[model samples]
Target: MFPIRDHNPSERTPYVTIGLIFANLVMFLLTMPWGLNAEGLWVYGALYAGAVTQGDMMWGLLTHMFLHAGLMHFAGNMLFLWIFGDNLEDQLGHLPFLGFYLICGLAAAAGQISAEPGSTIPMVGASGAIAGVMGGYLLLFPRARVDVLAIIVIIVKVFTLPAWVMLGVWFALQLMGGYTTPGDSGGVAYWAHSGGFVAGALLTLPVLLRKGGSRFWSRTDGHPPHDPIDYGHRSRVPQIPRR
Candidate 1:
């Protein structure tokens, strides 16, 4: 299952979010195999736990967030950013939101470095940072409705779920993956994802408190402050029947 959209809408344009997406896309294209000196760029941009722990190539902590291993990785991270970023950007404002994003990303890098300080494999992608955005979105709008597309064999279905359920499940999976898989095996940076998520939520607590905390939840009913967008359709999807 993957989240496709949300009912929550931002009251203003999410300029920072759009800019982030565009920047990531440009970076991806620049780092593509056929692009200019892709190998050299990856060497300079990708994060390596060993390099960081040894006080070398420390810049990867920030640069790695803009790098992706492949097309699918870039697409997935961008999609998540697009879906949940606007709401947080709306709440935090553009410059602050941008700072929050980078801070969360740094925290994610720290998490990964802590997990495998001696590993030499390079870590790439915006997932750890986008995971932070999801974290903030969950804290701010736990009850907001999100549209998820679930595929089962030949059956395709779209369903609406509360933000907590969707994000909660995603977080749980990350924790599970973190524990089950070895950190230096060079796969998903589960620790970074979980760490960034937790950091994002904790970071967003101040904003939540300033908004009247529980009173704010009561006023907005755990949703966005503005009116929700109605897609004017049900969650059912056209599916082919089995023989």
Candidate 2:
């Protein structure tokens, strides 16, 4: 299941979030086969655990957040960013939000490097940073309604759920994967995801406290500070007659 949209909408336009999405798309185009087709781009841009541990290619900590392994990876990460980024930007402001995103990305790289310092795998993608955005969103608006599309084989369903439930499940899966999967196996960077999430939430704690902490939650009722948008749609599934 993946979130399609959320009921919460930011009062101000999220320019930084839009800029990030555009930057990622541009980077994808530059690295794609039809574009530059430069294999060296991955070597230089993607984070290498060994290189970082050795104090070389330190740029990868930030560069890797803009690179992706494939179209699906790019699309999925961008989608999550789009869904969760705006409200955080609204809350954190433009420049601070950008800083928060980069720092979370760095923390994610560190998490992976700590997990597999000797691994030579090149980790790339904005998943870790966007996972941070999800973490922040969960803390600020846990009761916000998010529309999720669940696909199980031929069965399809769309449902609205609290933000806490969706993000909580996602975070749990990352922890489970991090524990179950070998660190050097080189598939999903589960530790990076988990670390970024925790970092994001921790970073957001100051803002939460500034807003009076529990009182803020009481005032907003764990939702956005404004009225939630209503798309006026409900879940539905089509049926097929058996032959």
Model 2 worst lDDT run, 10 consecutive residues: 232-241
lDDT of 2 at 128: 90
Model 1: per-residue Cα lDDT over 1-243, one tens digit each: 999999999999999999999999889888888765467777789999999888999999999999888888999999999999999999999999999999999989888889888989999888888889999999999999999999999999999999999999999999999999976898899999998998899889999999999999999999888889999867588787999
lDDT of 2: 0.93
Per-model clash counts, in order, read: 0, 0
User: Which lDDT tens digits does candidate 2 get at residues 1-243?
Assistant: 999999999989999999999999998988989878876787699999998888999899999999998898999999899999999999999999999999999888888888999889999999999888888999999999999999999999989999999999999999999999976998999989998999999999999999999999999999899999999856687666999
Worst 10 residues of 1 by lDDT: 34-43
lDDT against the true structure, each candidate: 0.92, 0.93
Extract clashing residue pairs from model 2: none
Error of 2 at 187 (Å): 1.0
